[model samples]
Target: MISRSDWLRDWQLVTRTALLILALTGTVAYAGSQVPIGKPPGESEPVPATMRGRFAGFVATLQFDNEAWTDAFVLAPDRRWFAEYARDATNIRVKDLRSGVTLRRLRTGGRKISGLAVSSDSRIVRAVDEDGKPLAWTVATGKSVSSEAEAEGINRIDHLTIHRWDNDISEPPGPTANPGQLISRFLASHGLSEQLPDLQTIEQVTTSVDGRYVAITEGYLGHLTIRDLSNSSAPVTIEWPEDWCGHYLASFAFDGHYVVLGTHGDEGDHAFTDAAAFEIKNGKAKALWHAECSVDRDAPEQISRDARFYAIGAAPNGPVVVWDLRAARRAAHFEGVYVAPIISADGSTFAVTKAASKGRRMLVLRHGKRRRLDANIEADPTGPIEDGVYALSSNGRYFAARIASATPGGKNAVGVWDTDSARQIRTIEPGGDAANSWKIAELSNTGDIILLADKSVFKAGRWIDVTEADESLLRGRSDSQLTPDNKHALIKQDLFLASFTLREIATGKTIWSLQGTPDLGFVMSFPDGRVRISPGAEKYLKLVRGFAVKPFDANAKRQFLRH
Candidate 1:
């Protein structure tokens, strides 16, 4: 009787287990099964409802469908990165992160994107199109544009050449004992970068702000390659796509996630046909947004980014239109602002300088009211503002510019004007540099102007005459700064500080001197309680303004550096 009861219980447990297995398998079958959807096993996996690339990591590069060949490219500031094929090459395409995987690519459309900011977290991106003011899609997750199998017809001569960064040193990868350590390791890994003396023949060079990454469109659309600058010399390359018509990358930029491209060529002529925006995923670029624009060209042209606004205007002067990517259309329309519009730092207002007038050249401020501050000094017709010259500052109260006189003696003057009454306030005839050679890059109102000239930077104003040895010591060094008094300077020379000297503001004498290399460059105190020399590259520059020399308070930083 006991054995028979045990057998019945076992049978019941087996039955329950079988039921559970059947349910779980049924669910799995729905998601992944040998049978196809309403079909047989011939269809392996279900096709993605839509295919796209997601930015998965940093340091992504643009890969083109160049028949297994590779091309180097840059992202146009505000447009799509277009990749065209070589004239002799076919089968232009790129791989998924150098893997055998392929992605769906769109090769058309473009629009001016304003209010574009890289996401702080470096995930997604958002932009406003001042022209197409509609809140379309920010994430490069949607949209489809037309594309040809191979981007063939773009002109070769028109494309730009990229300067290659190469190095030849070997070392273990770790925190370096020297600045060039990484560069040395790279050279050691790759051997020597080919010396291309003829590279100069290929003009139209575009480089990153840091002069790090470079791309070239050469020989009338001939060859392209992306170099792993990690090792400057031997750039490891993943070439050509199998299926797509050899589409070589024309230009590219990063929003920290996806790589973007704007197409330009015979294939992509109309707004719907020629330009495109895409994102890089798995080492492949997937198309995002594309639009047809009134602009079209047989050759690719460069576009600038990082400006406050961008607009497409009709020939002549119909209306100045700004396209906002967020709004997806032309957002603001204004007249008189059509010329070169430079926005102030605060974003509250802007100064508009018209394209060279036939006989009239003037500068205007766009606040609530249209205000003219300077006369058309452009009447001389020699050329705008003389070569290398620039206006430093112009607030309704004070306007300064590096100007040239008609006569040779009419040298460049840092002119200041009182805009409230439009009267010349002070004309600082700070001698030096050709007409525009002097640019007032920054003014801390400490009466200092950092100026750049002939590969040399001068800290000038009434505040000149630092120690000669100190100046020589500071040569070839960047970020080392001089105190406003011309006395003490944070010296960065030959990788070490020769010394620091405190100067007399009135007579230009070293009152105190010290030695250290901890900080270098022209001294600038921030309103937020931070003191630094002109940051980074600004050290190699000379910033000229109305006040060639600004008088500063040693303790002014105690108060926030306010406007």
Candidate 2:
């Protein structure tokens, strides 16, 4: 009925139609592949399972069933272990991050604990109860020991305080504690005498960054002993001159080659404190230049990352003096007293909150000039400014401060200021008096501020609410933080079932997650590529060490800086 040419053309048309339909279906499948799994209905499109597994390297070290609450948590210096003591618990539990195993359980005599400190090797945990009694226990044996100062007290007022030098040093003083009894008992109980420091006189003990050298201050004004733990010879003891009343090792040089010590005593009828540096190789001490200024006994001094500069809040209500360690001279001084002075790693910039003429203000000193931050905020003030607490970013790009409200009956607000332009870029009020004097938990290296906004943990610039219910379930939630690269944020979020999520900071997309208590504290990352998290058990923690990959898209990476 039809010609042969006509029939062939008809067949070709049907085949072409079929091919076009197949191509469209293939394109749709590829688009769906980009969606991520477990995304909320309205959050965004999902990321493909392929891409999620691309960065799959999270290894869980410990898993246990334990409830988490507001507790005193401390991570060891080496990032190998951590300790958690709950407010209502009777025992302090220590766990190893690498193995997720209980290292020790130090019993507290039904006393409320106020603070905690851990030794470098995770072998010792010192805790102070509500009654001012400090007890030290060996991690392996859980054998408790007390110093003379801790044993006998008048109002039971023991003047001993557990001090942490920088982030790496946590040395609780056994000052008047019997070293013979403490070390012998620990050695005999653990059968590891050769692995411990065999020395007396622990006015203060600080370990080097590499854990190779141990510096111990004998009496308040006594000699300092630096023992090379790897070497068998006698430890190097550097005696302080007779006039010095108190001598304490402040910090170690970045290269771990020098130690800085502070000396305080009556110098010519006036009490004074000066700092000096000792080269570990030569065992010789060099005195750094003093500011002719008195140091605050309560507030700790701020040291630069390189140990080349020291900013001492010259007595309360005095100007902050910046000392140059390399030149051993006074570099510069500010006009107002600093409650907390922050120094950049390079020693090129300094930030502090000082008393202003009208109210408290924050100032950053750099390039021999001072830039005022509070005056440049964008808010319309209806009243005078009030007190504020500020935290600086690691790169000196931005600073976040929770300043008291300037309007009648208004709540306090948190503002982020740009250090480069010296202006407020963003401001957020968490809607309550609870925002007043908000304690900054952790500021990521990339300038993201993780702080306590009201009762919830606010990340970057937004409030992370996980449920329709109240926030009573999130009571003990500490601050969250971004990894060093800023690509991923470890935020405590409710998976609707008590869990945590590692969201990509740029895209707001969660890359890794686990089911656990919201009361998790991120311990430091180790060189071996392990990331540790606290609250491993109800009272313990687990270490997560795996792939350190960035899963941010190009657009997401740009957004991290935009905000």
Which candidate wins on lDDT?
A: 2
TM-score list, all predictions:
0.31, 0.31
Query: Which ranges of candidate 1 are over 4 A from the true structure?
Result: 1-337, 356-360, 377-388, 391-397, 406-408, 433-436, 443-450, 455-563
366, model 1: CA deviation in Å?
Answer: 4.9
lDDT of 1: 0.31
After the best TM-score superposition of candidate 1, give how far the Cα of residue 172 lies from its true spot, in angstroms: 41
For every candidate in turn, the CA RMSD to the true structure comes to 29.2, 21.9
List pairs with backbone clashes in candidate 2. Answer: 35-46, 35-47, 36-46, 36-47, 66-538, 536-540, 536-541
Q: For model 2, what is the alpha-carbon lDDT of residue 370?
A: 77
Instruction: Write one digit per residue (lDDT tens) for candidate 1, span 1-563.
Output: 34875477445433433322332122112224431111111111111222122211111111212121122222323332222222222112222221222222211122222222222332222333334332221123212222221222211222232222222236455543454333333333444224333443332233221234443334332443334333454321223223223233444333333443332333443221222344545554455543232232111000012222223333232233443322223334456523333333222234433444443344544344445655443323332233223332312234444545545666655555544456556555556543345455433222234444544444435334445443333332232333322222222211111222232322323232222111212222221222332223122212111112112233322221222
lDDT of 2 by residue, 1-563 (tens): 66786477445433433322322222111233432212321121122222123333322232332222213345565555556553345567655533335444466644556656676676676766676666676655555655334522211112122222212223354443333444344223433345445444344554443344555555554566666655555556565544443334442211234343344333232233323334445545443222122322323245554444556554345566566644535676776555456776567778766555554677888766778886433222222222224566656677777655556777776677777778888766665445554556444445666655445556545565434222322323222333434344444322112233455433445444433221212222221222332212222232222212232334322322111
